[model samples]
Target: MIRILFTMIAIGALTSAQAQTIESGSHSTTGYIKSDGTIENSSHSTVGYIKNDGTIENRSHSTIGYIKSNGTIENSSHSTVGYVKSDGTVENSSHSTIGYIKNDGTVENSSHSTIGYARGVKKEWAAVVYFFFKF
Candidate 1:
């Protein structure tokens, strides 16, 4: 199963000149931004978000890495990018999702899911399943 690496909360807002506002643990409409108001780096445990003019990226788990808008979530060692939705869902990149995922170390930034697999999943989606075939 995937896990959280790091999470940092800064109780301040960065100016629009060099950065934007990032209210730690604020479940409001606006999320947090980096010092540049564009680029976001991992503080630890949660997600590092970038201001894309819409949809404030809440948090991701990664260590000593950077974030880009071209749909890329990078990590070093056991770091990962976590996902959170409006309906209260948390997804990580390390989870195999179903049974097709392994520790190949190539997970994408998907919502409430692991980047390894997306096959034979339930339509309703109750919980994360890990199936092992018996030979």
Candidate 2:
């Protein structure tokens, strides 16, 4: 009986640990960019933000990178990661295109795959943007 109880406790501890790890993973935010360059989530939460100088911040308000006026996006370490074009198409640092956000609010990939959409508007337009990850 003691052995069975110990096993159960071990299982419970493992399950709890796994849950914590999953909860700490990257979180998705559905938000709009304010005219002042702040990113707010649907719940009105400030998931991230943009600065006048084009610096971007994460939910924790940590400086993640910058977005230049020319639409070039760079990381905090100053590495080119992607670009946001005038036509609404987003491209990687290598200039390889991934998707575009249409005027009607549709986000489509190179293959024309609809990934997501944006709604509403502000003095500064908001877009359904994606971040490029480098392995």
Q: Best candidate per lDDT, number? A: 2
Task: List model 2 lDDT by residue over 1-115, tens digit each.
Answer: 9999999999987754331000001233354555555666556656677778877778777888877777778889989887778888777778888777677656667777766
Question: Which candidate gets the maximum TM-score versus the true structure?
Answer: 2
Off by over 4 Å in 2: 1-29, 120-128, 132-135
Please state the error at residue 73 of candidate 2 in Å. 0.5
lDDT of 1 by residue, 22-119 (tens): 22122221222334323232232224433332222334422233232332233333244432222323344553332122222112233323433322
TM-score of each: 0.24, 0.64
RMSD of each: 17.2, 13.9
